[model samples]
Target: MTNRLEQTKALAGEARLAVLTWLAEPDRHFAHQETGKPSEIGVCVTLLTEKLSMAQPTVSRHLELLRRAGFVSVRKIGRWSFFRRNEDAIKDYKEWMNEHL
Candidate 1:
């Protein structure tokens, strides 16, 4: 019971919800690609910054929170960082919620 409450608190942040909503719209959240466009891949931090209209550090902090919560995954290539929704984690969360609450 205590552990379940802790899990709820951890995922209940406003910024984390906002980030999830943003990621829900991949085409709107990601940049245009030469070929596949938004479907090409994950969202860049800079793009997330612009979409959220928040400072880089603020976005970074929220992203870190989400990463810790297992709601998102971060990948780095060269100097750029990309973030994508962790669908499996989300599915697990839903299952837990259904089973427990």
Candidate 2:
């Protein structure tokens, strides 16, 4: 399991932070997706890349870190990689902050 410090590092930086914020309300932020419910299946990386205005590799790297940190969850539908925030883990983190920080 990843330590708290590692998860903290994953949440660092502007792009990654924006990613989490967008994922917090995928339906509102990424409402253009016509394939599936973003809240349930997650948003496509292509859409996220466009939203972030960053390279796919960069966004993918940020997502990978978040996935490892348990702040995000991913789903694969054929060739597309969909991503969404892990609300349970986020709530736990918030509660942890309230108690420890």
Candidate 3:
């Protein structure tokens, strides 16, 4: 469908894929810090920067691209920003691939 094509086009960008690839391996890209509950847990921007060995602004730019592509979600807790995978979007993308690819 045209909608799927548009989404695919957005996701095909380089920065978007890098963010998704990082998210695909949470343990590697993020630190396992307890937040009392899993729902409140996500990869902190600082942790992500350290893992990627990149500047904060650069990481933020990449995150912005992924967010725009519907591949990730972000939440702010206090002064820190946390990012998590948008599983539903990913699942839908997989289903679309199965049907179209």
Candidate 4:
């Protein structure tokens, strides 16, 4: 149990935490561009990279971590990938933290 808790904490590192925060309010954090539309599915990776002020690859790595942690969901469109918050998973995580931490 302790190991699992520590692992979970480690997974939500600073960058991933920031990603989750921004993803919570996609409309405010990411802009809708002419090339892509922001919807319930998610915001584009390009917008995320710009908003995060990080390279596309770096942002993608962070997003991948968040996805593995079940904090975000992915939607692949054409050649691009969009991401959005997984509210249910986040809620469960919070509950687990409250109970365990």
lDDT of every predicted structure (CA atoms): 0.73, 0.89, 0.72, 0.75
Pairs in clash, predicted candidate 3: none
Q: Order of all candidates by TM-score, from best down to worst?
A: 2, 4, 1, 3
Flag the better candidate by lDDT, 1 or 4.
4
Provide the RMSD of all predictions against the true structure, rounded to 1 decimal.
3.4, 1.1, 3.3, 2.9
Which candidate achieves the best TM-score against the true structure? 2
Identify the runs in model 3 with alpha carbons over 4 angstroms from their true place: 1-29, 32-39
Q: Per-residue alpha-carbon lDDT of model 1 for 24-67, expressed as tens digits? A: 77777564633234434567888778878889999898888778
- Per-residue accuracy of model 2 over 1-101 as CA lDDT, tens digit each: 54778788987888889999999899999888988989989999999999999999998998999998899999999999999888888887778779987
Model 2 scores a TM of: 0.93
Residue pairs with colliding backbones in model 4 are none
> 85, model 2: CA deviation in Å?
1.0
Residue range with the least summed lDDT across 10 consecutive positions in model 4: 1-10
